[model samples]
Target: MRIPSTRTVPTRSRTAVVDSVWSDAKEFLTQFAQESRGATDTDRRLREVRSAIEATGTYRHTTEELTFGARLAWRNAERCIGRLYWNSMTVRDLRHLHTADDIAEQCVEHLRTATNGGRVRPLITVFAPDRPGRPTARLLNEQLVRYADDPRSRQRTHLAQGLGWTRGDKDFDVLPLLTRTGRDDTPRFHELPSDAVLQVPLTHPQYPAFASLGLRWYAVPAICDMALRVGGVTYPTAPFNGWYMGTEIGARNLADTQRYNLLPTVAQLLGLDTSSDRTLWKDRALVELNLAVLHSYQQAGVTITDHHTESARFLTHIEREEQHGRTVAADWSWIVPPISASATPVFHRYYDPPNPHPHTAFVHHASAADTH
Candidate 1:
């Protein structure tokens, strides 16, 4: 929608139908009307919502409201540092589709649309939400697409294998999309076609042999398995994506102890002294690895940001938000870059601690079992 603002969002309901749910919905609609600058008819919409709640157990969000709420969720995401472009994200309304097959198909489409031939775009595809009598469909992968056989994803890999999927003998195979229509439905797996999944192979700018390590990462990091809540409505299958920050691939995914643990390998390739931690071999290797990630994505014509630039943009986002009469909520540990945490401007300040409020639109963390 080009960020002009149009989103429809609904909530998962249990017992809040008559009392708490309506109260939460009222609070959200009020804020939405206030922020909408009186474009919305708060009184009329409230009446409609009140009627819907009395007749059914839930109220549906208008498409415009959904779009706005989705963007609001992005802005309110406490752990994210790239919220400056939250409003720019595309909200795909696929709420009508509730089957495992339909969701898998649109997920593939979501990847293609977000990838945008290496020019990654921020996007979210909201699938059918849970309702009173029926459960919602959900994607079972932590991400819509992930490299196969990575140590960190072995649990998911095994789950796919248990579902009668074969693992190809490739270093970085894209795992199949696992889905479940409801709590009782047996999960299904759909392999992602190659054209829909874009990947960048890692190569250092200076080291010619670095490419031999066969390091790679998918272009779009579509976070699946997270629950999207709007006005008390919970969408269990809302998948979203933003362009990668180099450290997400270089500092943590590839270099973490439990993951690929490639720093030691890169250190030897760089001829760094590895006798002890005092040698600072890991430090030298991390910098080069990060450099490689940034360089490779640039050369491949893909969207990626370095830790330094992103941190600066985050501070800008806060300034812009403050000017709009809003306080940007941030978590210090997440706002600070994992690599060179002290050098970034975000390192100099204390941000608002995690203060998530009800009656707010937000994307929330899901349990590990949610991936199943």
Candidate 2:
């Protein structure tokens, strides 16, 4: 099927109103400068910057502040059980980039770097934000690599199949990055080169026949649609990712019925009786599927965390944060693993009420596929 064209968004100025800019700048600088050495001098500089913002209706973050804020956002992520490594996140400042083409190239580069030849790394790349004359830039792909599901569409132009993978191929397809430079700009789609994406074909250690299933998945899950909010400034096109926890793929991505929904197929292949829930065929297939994911990633020399170990590590994270006198806010639904929820310790504990972290946070955007 040929890819559908998107409508151009009308351009509009986004300069912060004078009063709001003044308030946000003053609030942010006060908190930022208070934490740095030589507070008196930094406070004076803050006043000067605030005055400039009042006059110009905008301000730029210093490299130090940008780095701090980006890391803080990760630290503030309530749904992430992997925030134990939040401090280790690397920030790439690309705020100067204003074009979608440049952003797309950098995003591809991000995938390559984070892929790390199978050992993934946590990282984020900041892009330009909406300003007076510039409309916000955006990436249309949910992740750098995601499968497309529409089968009946007529438009088939690009890639080997002329569209995404056909349903008969188990629908393992790669989506091109679609983006627009600004609200007024025309959208364009760019296909990712094969060398840049690292995928692991799944197989079981005990069930050698599992290899015939032809199941595979990308190594890194780089989330690309969220806006990064730092010190009251919003960057609509910032893309970020942490290394995967196994269940994110095994239990959720591959097992979810709306997604690949391979449990019934696997059960049939394994010769298990699936006439009723009492047979526990679904449960048996789920265990094998997760095992295949973990084993395959290990065989491929990739980084992945088993849900059990990660759940324990999350407790350690909570303790460390508590020792530092910081409350660890978390959503119980997200903190618990998708499968074997009652089997993990995180399932039994009560956590601090979820609250916004002052320094950093990863916030969601509307579904990218819905935006067009």
Candidate 3:
């Protein structure tokens, strides 16, 4: 699946919302800490942090960038995984161009369109220089320079060596030629193609770039994965439900702090019941985590195993209780049968004694019979 792209507007808006949420969370934590020490500086510190974040725009930009990056990472991860399993194309297929010029043109087009029409050029790699009709690396470089130097060329461009030609070269000085003529010109490096590879860089500017390639609902799994990471779980197949439960509990703890001043209705919506005992809190947290996992898996087109029969039964009971306003007969006797053992072993004999060797048996000596 392609990575989802963020639009200009929502990207900005999401940054703001996430920033606010983080600020509130931090403030709540600080207040809780202060309360433990019986200090009254919570309100002052909260105001100071909020104003600082707002003034510096740090919260907005950082959160926006983070959200974008996470989304991009999720998308690229899916693509990489998909390619591992399914892609039939190879590097040679991608590198096939009619001529060196054609390849250069294709690279230039990609740079322009993909990078927002930036005035940047591509470094082309030419192979097999001595062979008939194959363009020499030197000749290709010259052509790129000529194209960039043309008066009609509104876009400033540059060309540099690719690995195929760069080999054995010691004192290459193409940097000056590729450098911008004026300070206002766009600066883009035409790195050797070997420096570039098929794998997406985690630090690429587009790492956080958003695209609307798939359904928005597909984001649930991605977000859940991020949530898991935030809670310090490293392995995907680990008991992520427990980690999610811990996160919910942490969020509840934050909500209960005086700094949050969370509305009772909002708290309830978030699965936080202030009056619940510690044991109930733990149970509720686990249930919420399980529900989140179920929802996320469903969004990702995964089916949960029928092993959660007990959970299903419990949910059914709760629904019945709400609808009837009274307790109904509870059937807690459901039992899953154990696997049965294999049937009794049957031995197959390959050889059979001669049906009586009647003559030999009749002739058996008295001594032989006694020995037998």
Candidate 4:
């Protein structure tokens, strides 16, 4: 969630051994066993998983096991800054669904469920996983919903067009979902119902002219690029989401040169001197843009968090996890807010190394088109 920066994970190009699968399963199950206080038969479960992996080249996770693993994956995502509410995520077991039509519908359902009428909820929908020699489906879009005709979404936008999806004229147009059921299967485009997408039109709290820019963003940032790995099984189509952090929208998505690049426009509107970067015109505009994003989301009653608040919450999260004797891994460079680096509490502290932890999900690849 939080539409994290690029992260690379070991992709499952070929089947791994039983030992590899069991090792991850054991670590995950051991934690669950502790939570269960030995109520569940851990040893027996481990034996079954090992045997299943040996026989089928992959094992299955029960709904409970899957839910537990999904939660842990969110918890172990070191690049994410919004892990404070990781345990609140709901895991949808759509493993039985593999058809392009079925997976497409569930993805829409995921959007509706996560959107929650703008009170977005954290959720993940696990579709069919890659088998020994049979790979499952993958969503081509970086996110379930994104603006069309933007630099960030050009590749996917073109891909959708190639799939017979007509491009929209406006930059804020939502792209269709492209689902690939198998390696040989042609990707199908699925149009998202307009009701499922809740967008907040941006406006500055102070500047009336800012509203005319026609800037807005989708409410839910459901990321679909990351493959969900738990116990050696890889669910290539597991899409998960958390609410946005304000700076992610303002400082990165809107302000970054590669993204919407709205700073120059905001500066012009504010009548700031663009004659030189020495005037800090860009800095002033960046802050204003970030403010507008946070302000507009609040005005629209959508679920969003400001960087200052999220940073403090992340610190609180570290403290809470430490109390339970769990190591909360974090990448300091990724965790720190892009703006106001010195003001947040998270800026002063160090964290665990950004190593790949077992049972985690975030492996950003599509770069969140059109993100933030």
RMSD of each: 7.5, 6.2, 35.4, 7.2
Q: List ranges where model 3 is wrong by over 4 Å.
A: 1-49, 60-69, 72-188, 193-195, 198-372
**Deviation from native of the Cα of residue 76 in model 4, angstroms:** 0.7
Per-residue lDDT for 200-288 in model 4, tens only?
Answer: 99999899999999999889999888888876677778899999999989999888999988899999999999999899999999999
Best by lDDT: 1
lDDT of 2 by residue, 188-258 (tens): 77778888889999999999899998888889889886778776677788888888888888887888887
Better of 2 and 4 by lDDT: 4
lDDT of each: 0.85, 0.78, 0.27, 0.83
Candidate 2's TM-score reads 0.86
Candidate 2: C-alpha RMSD after superposition: 6.2
TM-scores of the candidates are 0.93, 0.86, 0.16, 0.91
Better by lDDT, candidate 3 or 2? 2
User: Candidates 3 and 4: which is better by lDDT?
Assistant: 4
**Per-residue CA lDDT of candidate 3, range 8-66, in tens?**
66667756864754554354335334423433466665565566545543222122222
Clash pairs detected, candidate 2: 1-155, 1-156, 2-155, 2-156, 9-183, 72-360, 73-360, 73-361
Estimate candidate 3's RMSD in Å. 35.4
Q: Rank the candidates by lDDT, best first.
A: 1, 4, 2, 3
Give the per-residue lDDT of model 1 (tens digit) for 78-127: 89999999989999988898778888999999999999999999999998
lDDT of 4: 0.83
